[model samples]
Target: MSSTGPLQPLTEGGVKHAIVGTLEQITIALAITVPLGLACAVFLNEVPGGYARFVRTIVEAMTALPSIVAGLFIYATVILILGLEKSGFAAALALSVMMLPIIIRAADVVIRLVPSSLREASYALGAGQWRTVWTVVLPTARSGLTTAVILGTARGIGETSPVLLTAGFTAGLNTNPLSGPQTSLPLATFSLVGSPQPALIARGFGAAALLLALVVLLFVLARAIGGRGPGELSRGQQHRRVLASQRDVVRMSARRPVPEPAAPDPADS
Candidate 1:
């Protein structure tokens, strides 16, 4: 229907605009959420006492906050107060807000699971708190962190209300997220599927299928990249292991007993 149909909405750009808009929203949301979430997680893990607990409680509360609420919050704060136009950035901000709590909580759990002994070992090696966290704690929790990020992405990408409220959907492709309207997959699907025309409905289904495929691809790529945990050696780690083995061999060879008995035996013969 998209190829030969009379529906301009479906066949005009072949849903490329929707695809690009979804990618833009997800990318921008992740870019904002990941570092902030990780930092929050690290802070929560490293800090002790009532303040951390209070913050954790707040984040946990936010985890249950409705997507619509998030959208409204951004709409009021960013769009209304800041006088910013409805664009992909506003949508991204909403999505980021929705994603942040999930990522932070998951990351906190993962970082906490990182053995305390590793942190101790780093400190024993004269590493400071920040250095230990950066080098030891984070790498140890890398796989779990990746999982947290993926989970957040999955949740944010599927949300329609927030994007609809903030993004102000457009049919045409708008690459610049900061200016003009953008239409994500979920928003596009919702808009198209709501149409009275059958061709538009078919295109909506097609857009939904495309969104599903994109999500699957992201999941696969994330798994492939993050499947390896702390126990698995990367290329640099393998090289370092090889170099250490060579050093050990050299040290052992140097410490081996010299052959004074052979000379004595030859002289006796």
Candidate 2:
């Protein structure tokens, strides 16, 4: 974090800038990749037509594609042809390209794991194919979908070559990812570890450690979000559930059918 050099003063290089830049790039990349990946997966699994196999083959091929190639593709198109400067946004685009296939493949598998009975029931109840996929299918496989997203995130976040090619190098902090050069933790670690200085090398290791911890934290969060039973809820969610039930009772009580008083028998009268 300090502006000081990787000099002899035992300067500790913090990854604050790298962390922020990574978050910015990843946030943008996820925003692009998640919806598109999910849609592609849905199309592949639920709506597989004549061309579905071709698309699936392409996604499978892209899964094994080299990261440097994605970076070069972005560099040639966005930078060389479109006249965009080296920025974190461009790096994020490259990351998106890398992440998209992983997400689509993982999500495709997850969506395919949905029980055929569920779709049959949904269609029997007058639901369309797309609606059934959107409502019943997606929710049922949400935990798996979250896992797929985590996989994609793991693939994108640790990538140094793509980030290095597009994001450029920066020592100081830069918050605006769309405008200027930015740095990610992996890139910072790569840059620092290559230096001849011991202090810089140590900082590089520290940055690498930080990146590992961040990935672990993300996995924990994903598990927390996705590892729930179908009818389970957190304490707060449970409280809300009760509150909603009470409100529903109140709202529906007036519509409840009232039993009429027993009619008197003629002899009793």
lDDT of each: 0.88, 0.89
After superposing all C-alphas onto the true structure, candidate 1 shows an RMSD in angstroms of: 3.6
Q: What is the lDDT of candidate 2?
A: 0.89
Ten consecutive residues with minimal summed lDDT in candidate 2?
225-234
lDDT tens readout by residue for model 2, 76-128: 99999999999999999999999999999988988877888889999999999
Clash pairs, model 1 backbone: none
Give the top-scoring candidate (TM-score): 1
Residue 153 Cα positional deviation in candidate 1, in Å, after optimal superposition: 1.3
Q: How far out, in Å, is residue 187 in model 1? A: 0.5
For candidate 1, lDDT tens digit of each residue in 46-132?
Answer: 987899999999999999999999999999999999999999999999999999999999889888778788889899999999999
TM-score of each: 0.85, 0.83
Clashing pairs in 2: none
Once superposed on the true structure, which residue ranges of model 2 sit more than 4 Å away at CA? 8-13, 220-269
